[model samples]
Structure formats: structure tokens, C-alpha cells
Target: MTTLLPSLPPQSTLLTQASQVLMHNYSPAPLVLTHGNACTVWDAAGNAYLDFTAGIAVNTLGHAHPAIIEAINTQAQQLMHVSNLYATQPCIELATQLTQLGRFSKALFCNSGAEANEAAIKLARKWAKQHKHPHATQILVFGNAFHGRTLGALSLTPKEAYQVPFAPLMPSVKVGVFNQTENLDTLITNHTAMVMVEPIQGEGGVNVATPEFLQALRRRCDETKTVLWFDEIQCGMGRTGTLFAFEQVEGVLPDGVSLAKGLGGGFPIGAILVNEKLADTFQPGDHGTTFGGNPLACAVGLAVLNELTQPAFMATVRDCGSLLHEGLGQLQVDFPQLVVDVRGWGLMQGLALAEDQLAVGDLVTHARNAGLLLVGAGGNTVRLIPPLVVTPTEIHHALGLLRSILGGV
Candidate 1:
């Protein structure tokens, strides 16, 4: 993975030029990343850091993997963008793979998790309007659930910081406690068009949904004819040791599910898998995207899927994921003054910090300076999501780095 782009200026000069031109949407770290391999990345200053953030869980296969690079190069040489009006082989093949895996009949492609969740929202609402009770237009979402920042997805995301600037969101949204079974029975009703939930709340402190609560939601959705949707943007695509995180829990299924983050291995592709019930509910003109199912994205998506769905690769994820989870759990016990709790499945984990310790932002900055990248989730959570291809050695190295940062090891 040699440098493909032209090298010119130092980190400070490059960052200064970027600041002059680029928008201030994101507050990035002081260092500028140049290239990466496996779970390690190099800054412009030539310092290498072990990456546990994995670009916020978007880089499924890690940076500059041979397969993903080949897919990108091959697709660039052949075809790139095609409007949704026409069909492409890559699109067809990728959709087939995803639908077959989810046991769904159809898929709607988009460019991000927000768009995928938005598609799910529209499909559920339209289905409710056409078939279910005409008055059934309410939507149920859990607290601390992060779908995306898009208007429709943001409306359901109940975080104050993210939703404060954008007020007057969609109406009829009833909030339910995630993993709380008692509140779900009464919170969801026939008036609910959709009940959107995350298998594990990634940005919301890595809180996992209880199997009992999921089963209860499934039963209630069945009884009320409401479409059950899962926002697997951050937790899906083999991150949870399954094709879909919901698969790990028996007797629970979704009418539709949205996917995005790792689908194309950081190539920016999204999709919604709708079961047979709402498969035919969407008409041709109901929803569409111009650049959603383009050939380049689909080709990369197919390549990533080909790599991820392999039996051997999945086994590695399970083994490596368990090791990572256990290491983090041990960290919690080792630093009770700093760590409040540790929770998650597979590699998508979180460590909630004690109020007495440093803020998550400061801790993340300290960890970054120590040559280990970590991201802060909502609340006092420090998120750790390494690439699926991360090795046992890399996991141990990351844990050691974290321990060193916390004044141990």
C-alpha cells in the first residue's frame, strides 16, 4: 500500500490548507492520517498507531486490503456510476447475496446508513398507510438508538446533543427503553407503524438488547401487525459474529433491516432488506436513488461480501472477538476507579467510565497520543471497534496500550 497520491506538504501545512477549505462539521484529532495496513495507521509525521476505532467501524476489511483495492481498481477500469433506472450485474449479484443472507425477498440500495434507515422508515410508513390500520402511523424507537443524522433517522434518534439544533422532528414517535421488557409491552401498540431498534446500541454506550425484550417486541409486532426494523449499520456485517446480529438471538426476526457501515468495506454503500411482508408494499415510484446501486459500489460490496461470508473468516472473527471482549472486561476489573462497566458483543464493545475519572474525550486524546486510536460513544463510553481482520497479537497490543494509558501495564 504505497502512497498513490502526490506528496507535497507537511502535516501542519496540509491541515491548515484543509481548514481553510473544508467545512467544520467534524472535530478531528491534531494528527493527519496518511496510510494504513491491517489494524495500524501512519500519521503524516510518520508515527504509527494501532487503530481500534476502524474509522468508526466503516473499514470492515481494514485499509488497503488486496481484495478491496483490486475491486476498486477493477471497477474503476470498467464502470463506475449508473443511474437507478438501469440494472447492472454487480448490483444484481450484491443484492442477491444480501437478500439471500437475510432471507428477504428484496433490497433497496443507498449510500449510507442514514439513507438505508430512511428507506426503512418510508417503507414501513407506506405499508402501514396502505394495509394496516389507516390510523397506524406512530413509530416506536428506543432511547439512545443511533440510526443516523439524516432528518428521518435523526427524528428517531433521541440524543439531546445531536437533536438539539434540529427541532420539531417527525411526530408520533414514542420512545421505549431499550432492553427493558416491561415498558415495551405497553409502549408499542397497533398505532405503531414501525418499531426501530439496534441489536446492540453502539453509540449509546454499547448496551445490548436483552433477548427477552427482543422476543417481546417480536411478539407484540406480530400481534399488532407493525413492521419491526433493526438498524444494524454499526453492528452488522460480521461485526457480531453473524451475518446479521439478530441471527445470534433465536426466535427473533425483523420485517425489515437497514445496513451500511461495513457493507462495502468503507466504500460507502447502504441497503435495506425487507422481508416478504413489506417487499411488495413499495411501488416502483415509491423510493429510489440516483447513485445508490452503482456498479463501482456494488462491485466493491460483492468483493467485501465474498471475503466476509467465508466460513474461515467468520471463525476468526468469533475467536478474535471473544479475546478482545475478555481483555476489555479484565481492564474493567483492573481499573475500577475509571471503568464502570464493560458491555458488547463481538468486537463492537464499550467501556463506560466512572464519573470520577477523566472525561471520555480527554481519555481518547490521551490514548491517541499513546499511539492507540479510540472513539467516544454517547455518555461516558469509550468505544473499541477494530477491523474484523485484526489479529490476536493486535488485540493484545491494543489492550496493552490502553492499560499503559490508564497508568498500568
Candidate 2:
């Protein structure tokens, strides 16, 4: 005989129950979000919040967009998953569009940013061994970089706190200073198989790479014949007022680009786009994923790409970004003691706090209490990454809330 299950408890008790059963990996806020629409989300207690985090920059078109919803519903009714053994129309079409948009010759799908970086790592190593010397296997990364938590990706992310527990990570990884073009020659050696850098370091306090720095890296990589890769997981896919962040930087392009986060607009999907030079790096059995290119995920990805590629949509992003930047600048001027600096491009902006006066977490809590959600990055910086569809009115309201919070503090 089968045992009957217990009834669900009230919404208020959900967090308590979660604490008992779930692992303590994430310390989420107290609010239990029920649903969302556009840039607004409502909790179980019926309180509405203007979401500036946008699910950590994963919700490209905002929550419950009609196109995303429709694509998911239609694709679910028809096809969802089929192993990579057979090809699917949505997968093929999405790949084709991505290749054309990213100006890459090939694409490899995966489940998350970590997986995409892992694939790029493997491809870089393999290509180096085949085309270059077999001993050229070093992977060069930068300081204050946050790639992902997976072993291979984690190895490249030079954080003492994240790496202390997981000792003995993947070997042959070197750390370099970000945006310091002076010492690039010393960092990237002939044995270096690949050099991975985030054009804009997200978790590292929105540290944007200078165009001169990127150009220097490209030149050095060419001199050493090393694969140049970019981790655009958080800053790519129209977040920076362009399809790719590299578009803003002239005379620089990566041999491979790893993408995820907003690619599927909330649906989980990751991909690596490689130029023709490294197009055939991965053989048939070299890399594969069970649910990477499933019909449902690819369908959602296509819908997101469709909306982001619209000329009007991208123009709106640029206009609103300028407005948001101006608002943040005003905040800095108003609260000179609290707000130290403001930085970032497009909709991905950050306000660096005066840590001596206010901590990032305290400011985040204040914003949440005032019905606005924000995310914190390194260097005491609070990120304001609202959806690409956020309006000027919502931005004004968010700024108003922030002004009130700072005034009250």
C-alpha cells in the first residue's frame, strides 16, 4: 500500500520547512516570491517589489513575458527533450541564429555558464595540443574574476574564499591582473593554451576591461598563438546595449565566447560560440550534454533572441541605461558620504558604497525593505540590473525608493 502525503503548510511556514529539508547553500531573503510580471514581483504576502536584480541578470525580457510564455507553452505541448543523439528543429534554428548573431562559425550547447566554460576550457586545451605544442596547456585568467563554481571554471576564478574549501583544483591555471596591459606579456607565456577574461568583470565589482587592455590581450595571444576566450555570462546578450559586449570594444574579438544567464530569458541554457579558427576543436565524443539543446530550452532561447535583436528594443536599452546612469550619479551627489562611486554600462550598473559608513548587505536590506530588490557585487558595490524591458517610469520609481532609503539612513 502507498502512503498518503501530508498537506502543504501556509505560505508563511515555507521558509521554515525549507530550512529543515534543503541544504544551506543559499541565504535567500525572507520574502517568498509568488509570481512576477514585467519588472515587478509579488510575494506571498501580496507585497509588490520593483525587481532591479532581474534574477541576477538572467531574466532578459522580464518575468512572464508573453513571448517567453507562449514559446514555452507551445514547445512543451509539442516536444521538450530528446537526447543529443538526434537533431531537433528548434535546436538547429537557435544555433544558426546564434552563430550569425555572434559572428561565430559553430556553437556548443550546455546546461549552465559553468558547463559552457568547461567546454571552452576543454576545447582550448585540445586545440592547443593538436595545433600547437602538446606542452602548451596553461590557462591564464585574471584577478577578481568570477567564472563559476564548477571544478574547471572554479580553478580559473581566483578567489580565496571559494577555493579554500575545494582544495587541489584543476592544475595549470595562472592568475593575471585585470585591465593591466603593461604586464600581459609576462603573464601569457608560450605554453599558455588559452587566456580567458570577462570583458566586464561582474562579480568582481563591475570592473570593465579597457579597450586598450583588450587590444593588448588580443595582440599578446596572437604573438603566443594562444586561444583567446571571453566569459560573457553576465554581461552579454543585450545587457550592454548590444548583442555582445565585445561589439562595444573595437579591434578585439575572442576565438571563443561562453554565454548563458540571459540567453534563455530564464530558461536554463548555456552555449559557447567559436570562430572558424577553433570551430572544429571538439570532436563527436569530445563533449556532450543530455539536456543542453533540448527543444524547450532552445525554443525559449530563440524567443529571447528574437526580442533582444529588435532595433527598437536595443535602442530603448541604451536610452534607459543613460537615464539610470544619470539617476545613480545624482544619488552619488546627494549622498556623497554613502555612495562612493557609480560605474557600468547599459542596464548593468553598480553603486559602490562607502563601506566605512554602510555595508553592501545593509544597503541591500534597506532597498528590499523599501520594496526594491538589488544585488551586491564585490568591492561593496550594489548592482542595479533590471530587465531590458524596464521602463523609464520604473527606473524613476526605483531611484525614488533609493533616495528615500538613503535619506532615512
Candidate 3:
């Protein structure tokens, strides 16, 4: 069976072959990437694209960065995997660095954003059961939110497109309007175990949450004793200029934070950072994973985190992000019909198209053809989640290509 298939298909046939062989889950972009350099990827056809999407914001330091390559190579030469029974240096070091970043006192490593969110859900429920209320289990999730695809994470995701077939999800999950301060009061009851939200709504079209809203949530959670979980998978790890998006706001800290995407700089690692009190919920035998804290992944993650945490590195991100955001907003003034609004913070930006103007997928496909990789999000938005390492010059080049495409559209 293995020998029957071609080793690799040509550029023209790759998409078609993938359709026939792979599951009908993702509506992938048409470009078939052959290799990637810093902030740029080349298609098999030899066309280069300024990667604004950054593999959906996973490649924080950009593709094939020298530091990342070195870390991965050095770790591969030493050890790969050791069971949770024995502690590994990379994992211990990475966890210590993450713990120092904020009020989070402990870290639970996983392999993806979904897995991290799943761990958060379990920790939240377990904490509630043991410390707060034995019967408290309900969780409050926001509308248009995307946590992950796994069953437990899926339960927290409210999008119908991701939930329809997998009906009868985990019980006691409620949907609340985002940024609505009053809604939290109604949604959070004694039975609520946790209230989950993204600091800046990523899949929900880059909507920024007001500090008032977060402050309200913090107050409500304090009164109700509910665990507050912030899903920072897409927007964390310097994707939003800051190490975490919530850091920009005053009095906006969560009891638990789930992070992935950019944490490994494309090496694939996720984590749940818990406050000191909530850290004790998980006992030894309660939760575990075979590949969670492997040395290779932790080494890569450690490098990525170290690079992103530098003050000078984040200052560059802020400058670049400001340049990109202002450039796009100015374009909105010229092409008001094609673009309704441009909004976001740092490199995690988005352009919302006018109602009934054009499908978001069409814009994404057009950008790919023009050698600029972009991704679409909810509410007819085209997300511009470039790598944090992207420079002002790269942002200008990418936006210029987008402007050229917009003139034709």
C-alpha cells in the first residue's frame, strides 16, 4: 500500500491528490510550500510569499530561524524523550521561565493548543470540585470563540460549523456575549466552574476586549469563586507585540492561561500556566501525556520564549506592528468599499470587508496568488497574523502587494 503512492506530487497535482488522500477537514490555501526562510516561504513552483499568516501565527521567530535550528539540532543530538517519571532539564527550565513571566506559578506542558485547553478545562473543573463547590461544573464561553477541535475543548467552542456533527457535547457549558460586562453577571452563577475568554478575540475577528470587561470578569469571578481561564493560543507569545495580550491591560490576569501556536516557534508545544492556588489541583496520577514535555520540544520552546521575552525584541514588534496597522487603516480610507475596517494590536491584525462585498476566502486566495500569504477569520475578516519577527520593511512589502490586489477586486 505504501509503495503504490507517489513520493511527492507536482505543484499542479498536490491539491488534488491531497483532496483524494486526506480528510475533508481543512480548506487549505492553494499554495504548496517547499521551504521557508525568515518570514518568507517558497512554493513548489518557486514563487516566494511574504508570510503574513506565519503558519497561522505559529512561526513566531519566522521560518527556519538560525537560533531555532541550532536549538533543535543540539537537542536532537542529546536526548529526545523521557517519561514523566523523570524530570528533564529543558522542561524544567522552560517551566521556570514561564512561571516567572507573571502571577502564574506552575505550568502543564502539552502538544497543541487544543490539548492545552483540554488540560485547562480539567484543571478548572477539578479545582472547582475540590476547593469551591463539589457540584460546580458549568463553564461560560464566548460566542464566535474557537478553543480547539478535541471533544472537551470543542465543548467550549461555540461555533456551529465546528460543533454540528459532534452534538451532545460536554454538559453545562453556556455561551455569553463577548465584551458585555452585564452578561457575565447573568452567566456566572454558583454552578459555573470557569469562564473562558481570549484577551483579544482572534477567530472572532480580532476584537479587542476592553479593560473594563476584564476587570468586571475578575470581580465577578472573585465573588463567585469561579476559575477564570484565558485562551492565549493564537494571540500570545509576542504575536500581539507583548508577550501576552492581557499584559497591556491593567487588572487583567487570569487564574489559568492556555498557550500554544507561537510558543514553540513552529516546533509544536502547548502549555497551561496556572496561578499558585489552582496549581495544586492536579495530583500525580490525575493527568499525563507521553509526548508532552519531550526534550526536543521543550528545547525549541525555550528558545522561542527566550527570544520573544527580550525587551528589545518586543520593541521592534511594537514599531513594526504600528507601521502595519497604520498602513492598512490608511488603505481603508482609499478602498472603503472593499474594506470596511482595519483593527487589531501589534502583528495580530485584521481587515474586515464590507458586508456582501466579497467572500473572505476569495481575498485570501487572491493574496496567495500575488505572493503574499494571508488568512481569513470570522465576520468576513482577513487576518494579518504575521510572525512577530516580521520587519517594518516586510510589512510594507506585504501591504503593497495587498493594495495591488485590492485595486483589481
lDDT of each: 0.88, 0.92, 0.88
lDDT of 3 by residue, 1-409 (tens): 1121235567779878878999988877766777888888887666788889888889999988998999999999999889787899999999999878856899999899999999998899999998888999999988888899999999999988788899989999999988898767789988989999998888889887888988999899999999999999998998778888889989778999999999999998999999998989999889999889888999999999889877699889988989999999988998998899888889889999986877888888998888888888898999999888888888889889888888898
Worst 10 residues of 1 by lDDT: 1-10
Using TM-score, rank the candidates from best to worst. 2, 1, 3
Give one digit per residue, the lDDT tens place, for model 1 in 166-200: 98888888888888887666777778899999999
In model 2, the worst 10-residue window by lDDT is 1-10
For all predicted structures, in order, the TM-scores are 0.97, 0.97, 0.96
- Candidate 3 residue-wise lDDT at 271: 93
Q: Could you list the CA RMSD of all candidates, in the order they appear? A: 1.7, 3.8, 3.3
Give me the runs in candidate 2 sitting further than 4 Å from their true place.
1-9
Clashing pairs in 1: none
Error of 1 at 337 (Å): 1.2
Deviation in Å, model 1, residue 52 alpha carbon: 0.8
Q: Which ten residues in a row have the lowest lDDT in candidate 3?
A: 1-10
Candidate 2 per-residue lDDT over residues 1-409, each given as its tens digit: 1121235355569878878898998998987787888999887666788999999999999999999999999999999998899899999999999999888999989889999999999999999999988898999999999999999999999999999899899999999988888888888887899999998889999888999999999999999999999999999999989989999999998999999999999999999999999998888889898998999999999999999988799889999999999999999999999999998889999999999988999989999999999999999999999999999999999999999988988
lDDT for predicted candidate 2 compared with the true structure: 0.92
lDDT, model 3, position 133: 87
